[model samples]
Target: MARFRLLPDEQLARSPLRELWREFARQHSAMAGLALFLLFVVLAVLSPLLAPHDPYLQNDALLLIAPSWSEAGLVQYPFGTDDLGRDLLSRMLIGARYSFGIALITVLGALLTGLVLGSLAGMSKGLKSSALNHVLDLALTIPSLLLAIIIVAILGPGLINTIWAIMLALLPQFVHSVRNAIAEQLNLDYVIAYRLDGASNWQVLTRVILPNIWERLTVTASMALSTAILDIAALGFLGLGAQAPTAEWGAIIADSLDLIYVAPVGVALPGLLIFTCVLSVNLVGDGLRNAMKKRRDN
Candidate 1:
């Protein structure tokens, strides 16, 4: 008699771990991209716990100080003080929250808007799909940075407006991806069978095509999240994102620019923080994409 046996958890089993290690080795390029990204996210999420001082409190006496190897020699300012005497280290920690927050919102908003529009376009063919695709393509043709600048200029520069601008810039990509995914799945036999069973287009989309396209949608959304963070950081750097008095990474770095010569550390510190955040997010996305691909291939 043959005995039933359970397979070990692949995530922990030695063979599976070996395969995972091999995957990492084979995809070192992607793994490196993801590792850098993860490091930044850990920094951002742990900012409050890790910050050395109250970022908002200012001491005019310490203004424009440069970073020093000895904590005591640096007047206890690890990353030095900004022009306003605000602790650069603290400001960087707080700035992480806003940059990460804006990116999250923008990506989620774009995903929701894109999925809905794309589903509609995919379900309805001929003129409807053509028109929607044309509009999305036109929007995509405009440089995202230029479009973001124009929108932010009109809407007034602020956190919410910046998020909106980023979303607007990203939504078209989602729309295109979703439309293609849905269009590809719509003709599958399962979908045709659902229609034969008297399901409406909406029902078919919601039950059949949508479910099938979900994996692609999720991957695209994850990728978009990473891009959104970078874009928001860029806007903040340009003085079009979180404004004065708000400790946004971009704003902090921008404010530190004038004092670059006086205290180069001031400029480098915030910039490094932003870079880490963006890098970590991209890493997580890369890891996720790779893991999913491996699963599908298996």
Candidate 2:
């Protein structure tokens, strides 16, 4: 049997998205990361049906039960029960929903905010641009997690507040990155040609600048998603986000902390999910960056 593969087309190039997929698929790590990412997403979506027991349901007798592989462990609770007697697997499935929600909402919100503000900063001149840059510089000095904590402190903690905090914390990074990218693109010969050909600022931005810089935006979004996941988990771990019984991964681990020695698997499972989620996003981002490098300038 013969095998076929896509090669980057020079003159008659494929559609931009299709070409990107071909490039992305070339990386084995990226493909595996994508698979793992999708698996989590599916689990999150189907949590209600897939979960054997109600996530919040507590069985007084099942407290601190080890995993099913353990001799005293019960078959009904595959991952066993937490100290609170809640099913670990059910809680994790439910928690994944919040994680994915935070990722998507935070990424989109930050991206939109960054685009509008960064474009203004990029296009403006003199004092306006200087002031915007200076403010962003100050904001960036605070790490994303710290910035998120500050916002959450003021807003008060909950799932919604956590989402907003992560989005705001991520905003400065996207703004700076976008501003730099836009500034660089503006000085390029093609952009100048567009300006000379009577393209309005909006037209140039929508038609040329954005299309050319999508790779940068996508990579930034990937990074933001991973950061958002970590921030949500950290905030929960710190007792500042997603209150008890919500099944958020970090809070789940917090509830099971006392059981770390008697039931290490409970704490480790949520941590493992968080680790894998962040790892998958980083791998995908790295793949996109490498693929973008191979792409010819638009």
Candidate 3:
């Protein structure tokens, strides 16, 4: 006789991370996105070892040089030189760290700070909660990019300021999402049961609510990361971030705008890198949404 086996309850599983990994792996697109993201991380990590030339070093002879494959280009400069004659390939490899590293930090900062604010808002009552919600509504009315610009303008243009600007711009989204999700979950039967069983609000949140909403938070974080990365590049392009001689992708594009018509690839390649990274992240986020939906359906 064949024996029937039951899957372990997700929350009770000894290795919930392993279970999540299995769920995450169910989506091929997510796996692909992860692979692409990892490739960028690796390239950034190994840039010093792998890059043939100094990213910031200039050679007057290599001015406006084409990629190595082009007839006019030298074999040494595989991705050619920028307007300043610095190695584009090396710059690109180095720039990956800025986007990925800063965005990761921004997302984590926004998540933690927003989570604290959201939890407080979700638990609070009366006029103060209403006032806070209204503030969030007002904040959301402004475009995030515009909000970021305003913050950057006040803070003055620089690398650190850009990070703070992006983080501030992203906070409202996380705060709103967490607040709404927690509020909704609080009214659910399981949450009420926990309360009736003498669980404190904090315990219910930690033991019951957060575990269920973990997937939603992760998906949001993934989406937020892509936005942060794009914003970093955009601010860099606008001369309000990263500054001159920095190899940031957006700044790289800005540097080559004059030659866009004459050497289109120089401009196009950086844009493509941004596009690919953003798309990969969005796909992963979408996959997480799908996985969460599937889990709920089952």
C-alpha lDDT of all candidate models, in order: 0.77, 0.88, 0.85
TM-score of 2: 0.93
**Residue 15, candidate 1: how far off, in angstroms?**
18
lDDT (Cα) of model 3: 0.85
Q: In the order shown, what is each candidate's alpha-carbon RMSD?
A: 3.9, 4.0, 2.9
Better of 1 and 2 by TM-score: 2
Instruction: Please name the candidate that would achieve the greatest TM-score relative to the true structure.
Output: 2
Winner by lDDT: 2
Candidate 2 structure quality by residue, lDDT tens digits, 175-207:
998899999999999999999999999998889
Residue range with the least summed lDDT across 10 consecutive positions in model 1: 8-17
Per-residue lDDT tens digits for candidate 1, residues 123-185, read 787887799889988998987778888889999988889988989888889999998898878
Instruction: Compute each candidate's TM-score over C-alphas.
Output: 0.84, 0.93, 0.92
Pairs with backbone N, CA or C atoms under 3 Å apart (clashes), candidate 3:
none
- Put down candidate 3 lDDT per residue, 148-234, tens digits, no spaces: 999999999999999999999999988898999999999999899989999998899899988877777898899899999899999
Cα displacement (angstroms), candidate 1, residue 298, comes to 2.7
Error of 1 at 6 (Å): 4.0
Clashes of each: 4, 0, 0
